[model samples]
Target: MHDDRHAPRKGAIPTHALKAAQEIVVLKWRRTSFKRLDGSIDVLDDDWSLSIGGRSLARIYLLNGGPQDGRWAWFVQVFPEGTPGNGGVGVDDDGRAAREACESLLPPAIQQALADGRKSETN
Candidate 1:
């Protein structure tokens, strides 16, 4: 709804900020490899995924170019479906916000895990 929270990725589904069932939100993050212009693979530090129970739910990345270069972006996906468009673009600041913003789209376990002092470590 807000222009600042646009997902912008192709196949990104439009979602109305809903929290998924709590138990279904045991999320994890995994680093991703990117193919460089020279065809070399680079494991980026600013790009990673948001997973639930080891399955990918979305990706959080830093924009490489354009007016918003260096801004963090949220790329969400629903299994057997597509991605989320502008679901949580600029929810927070422009950097590292997706990591927090995307939480609203999923279960409350993320916060609960924190509250319980059991935050999942990045893998």
Candidate 2:
């Protein structure tokens, strides 16, 4: 019998190179508007992927609100690398991917805002 724990899971890709690239692949979709308690909201469909260590490490999906004009929700997927059975870090990895993807999808001005947020957190 195969020990699933020891076996490398499918779809696992090394992400070191992709992370080093510092460039993300961005996919954009049409925007949608909705009503919110606070006000009206617009959501955009944007997806992004990061390559690391010559492999694809993670992918992100962004849904940002308009009217409010900010991020409302995000979806992220992380592939396995350097881990047994291609396990995933789920919430943390997804959150990071989402944030990064969202930034990639933003306009120049909004992208600046995302960058600033990152800087503030680090400092």
What does candidate 2 score in Cα RMSD to the true structure? Answer: 12.4
Clashes of 2: 11
Listed in order, each prediction's TM-score against the native is 0.49, 0.29
**Top model by lDDT, which number?**
1
Report how far residue 2 has shifted in candidate 2, in Å.
4.0
**How well is each residue in 62-108 modelled by candidate 1, as lDDT tens digits?**
87787777778785555222243333334234645687666555434
Off by over 4 Å in 1: 1-27, 34-42, 79-92, 109-123
Off by over 4 Å in 2: 14-48, 53-56, 59-69, 79-123
Error of 2 at 105 (Å): 20
Model 1 quality (TM-score)? 0.49
Residue clash pairs of candidate 1: 6-86, 7-86, 11-83, 12-83, 12-84, 12-85, 13-83, 13-84
